[model samples]
Target: MMLPARGGPEPCGGNHGSGRDHSPARAMREPTAMTASPQPPSPQPPPSANPAATPARAAPPIRIAIIGTGTIAHTQHVPVIRAHAGFELVAGVNPTPVPWWAEATGGLKLFSSMDSLIRSGMSVDAVAICTPPATHYALAAQGLAAGWHVMLEKPPTPILSQAMDLHRLACAAGRTLMTSWHAACAPAIDPARQILASGGVRGMRVTWRENVRKWHPGADWFWKPGGHGVFDAGINALSIACAVMGEPLFVTGATLDIPAGAATPCTAQVRWATPSLPDGMEGIFDWTHRGIEVWDIAWTLGNGRRLLLSQGGGGLSLDGVAVTLRGTHEYECVYSRFERLVHDGASDIDYRPVALVEDILSAGQRRPADPSFRILP
Candidate 1:
């Protein structure tokens, strides 16, 4: 799940800023599987100025505009664009330009608004909407209609109807529209997907718990009706869920615990039924269990086989074997894939993932647990 207001380097919903999971070692892993059908072992990149900047492919990178120069924009998205050749770091938009340090991506023009950028002759080939979930629609629709390809950050938007409309418009315009499920782009997940596809799962149980107060601090926006707090991370699990299950799962039940006076759920316990697999398979997701947060996703197969995948969308500990990836690049990998699409046409929005989240939002309209979420001292 793409956590909201994750601005930069803040421990988001107990993710510890994802800084720990992605180590220098991650920078040393093998190339993604999609690059070559079955290439022979090749030399890896030695530590250089910026290994992450290495492009999956090289060319005149797409002139891309990153709308909303917020936290993730400066931290991950911009770096990915700069590191690769599939995209060019042409311009960015925000109330203010990214600071001098942010110029690492280089040759960036900061605009005050989308209209300003489009009118400035920046000639953007694509636009990555880095704005908050609530504002995604207005800006995305603007980009797509303007004839530039668009890549939207996760939770593509707070509204499903608007997202669906964006999808329609994208189709109508025949422009590449993508929603980056950053977790799904992890180069480390290839093995996990192999196991699931090999019929290793019979029944899977998933759990994600964390300490929000300490992590979020004064981020009061999370408790608002559309802030999408815990699910911000929870959706990462869902994307994995959709990847394994590979279809839209219907939400069977859910209990959202909201702060008493707040409009959004601080914690959520949800149940979803996956499409029939080898056996009748099902799963559960919990967004607010407190402490270091737990992401326990296990699969129980028939014939007495069981596999538990844990440690948050990172790796898989199959039956008992944990594959330690040399690298754990998420957004870098995502931007790599986007670069691929820009060079060769491709689309990567996981609707089934969003569909389930929408069901959860629609299913719960209850009172928040402590309402005092807003009155915090």
Candidate 2:
């Protein structure tokens, strides 16, 4: 939504950005009580309506395929698709077996790769990309040009130009292209937005730090150039910031901590703008913390009743006031939204948030870590 244009990763094409594509094997395995579309899907909306949000349509299950079976896919994508009724889990192509959740599903088809799948002659309405950031551009572009709708994992592309290209393509194709940020659906976000929406004016503080070894032990994808390190965690905060303040928070001053011996930042202390926002914000983030570190949000309300959020916006307390959460239903909600988009023949692939991440990277200065980082057990 914000910048230049480009093509898919392999060669490039479509609205501007890279897309993923491939084909199918058997006929789409339609779930009971749903219509088999000749086409795709998107995320779902609430069963009931709020005056602020649009009423969502309950769609028949959408015909779908998945590319790149990685950790995120095993943990989220594959599992969510099978468990939810809004989709027809048609194809799974990863150069390997359907990891855990996908394996649980009885009889879905598999492909060697997107290119292989498409060449095989099976039909699919949409493709879900769960690959790392590095490959997103190409994979996504292929999918879009092939007339398939796309649903991407977070921080769609490393560069703004690529993200812009994808956004433009989706608009032109009149197909759905959603770069979903799963964390936004966290329970604390809704009420947090409500508090800000009520119109209180004030300044804020934010901190997000986690033990990298605990989260990414052997997987060293962090410092890999485009593999945006801390912001990987910070995107959740960014998603919340936009939901609360309404637009991209202008980055004022930032110094990212690259491990002295590595490339990406392990921590960052920065200043951000909330101009015209009734509530403003500032923050600090780190991934080198030793033990369980903090992931929190705080604000000074107009009345001075400071509101705070921890557990990454799950447990909230206002001036020491605590709010209990029920459960997280994000995956189900994601499929539900997909169902609505497909039934309505619409796509929601916006690059605003991804663009913002790109902007932060492009604008921010890089600073190396103190002692530098090395492997640990």
Candidate 3:
């Protein structure tokens, strides 16, 4: 499959030139004390003799505990949390010894388990669960029950029922429970959404192919039943697509390519329908390409305008011209929104993407894995 061209230079990070304009606008000239002869100053109300009131103190940053110091926790979650002013990384929970980088970056107070972390009397207002998909439910549920706001990494749980249960737990505890669909917050997503909303979509296609060995390396969990195989990363594309063209109403058909002796599919082809799209509009997700990585989604509008979002939303082109989007700092954006969700006492848990994954798993036809294909060590 041909990947859509990214069309321009790589999106840069950091808010280098961005800063609030704090300088006051030019002061308006004091109106010339013209005619009106300042009517005899109306008697001014007498000032209270009590001491002046003090300003309210600012709330302290939300202390966050990082659960599972794995690849994502190290690469994205931890750095973003450390840089964001609204949050503080106070501790880390993982069975493995705390990674060197985690220790170097202020030596997070480490614990082998969630129970131990909670029992340690460490102050934490929220928890960022970065563990594998199968473990998300248990950890998130425990956090919510312990009165901590929870931010779960993508594919919130292995199945839809568990995700819904977490939502209920969060609601009962009156805490924020957010499923971080990082791709949904990409730079180009909002623009694509607006384009689709205004100009009806005729069709949509997604190509989310990448070499598992390159990205996941020796991760054995990926071949397990709940590991989600290709959909593990493909779901990011699905989430972005859903954000652009409303949620898929149903999975029309699907095919799973599972390796021999493996419980999960290494590659999957899924077709889904959405009322927002025209009748017979087919959306394709292909995750088996080997050479170059392709992470893109394209849409055909009713008026023949072709829109493409590629590089997992780092680049966008509408009818061939590069569409300028805000800087691409998806993880940063995720944490920023998470902070607001925590303060507002509201939850933003959307199960549409995961529900779609579950649908495919339940209905897709399974094929034997290629005999020559070797599982990455």
Q: Which candidate is the best by TM-score?
A: 3
Per-residue lDDT tens digits of candidate 3, residues 21-109? 11000011111111110001011211211122211326678999999887777767777677666778898998979655555458667
Where model 2 places Cα greater than 4 Å from the true spot, the runs are 1-59, 96-102, 277-280, 324-328, 375-377
How much lDDT does candidate 3 score?
0.70
Query: What are the Cα lDDT values of the candidates?
Result: 0.62, 0.63, 0.70
Better of 1 and 3 by TM-score: 3
Who wins the lDDT comparison? 3
Ranking by TM-score: 3, 2, 1
- TM-scores, one per candidate: 0.77, 0.79, 0.82
The TM-score, computed over Cα atoms with residue i paired to residue i, of candidate 3 is: 0.82
TM-score of 2: 0.79
Per-residue lDDT of candidate 1, residues 33-133 (tens digit):
32211000011211212454465444677888888876667656677676555677788888765674345555556889999887887678999998878
Candidate 1 regions exceeding 4 Å error are 1-58, 96-107, 213-217, 277-290, 324-328, 365-377
Per-residue lDDT of candidate 2, residues 27-117 (tens digit): 1111222211100111232222122332333655677888877666655666677666567788877876655534455667778788987
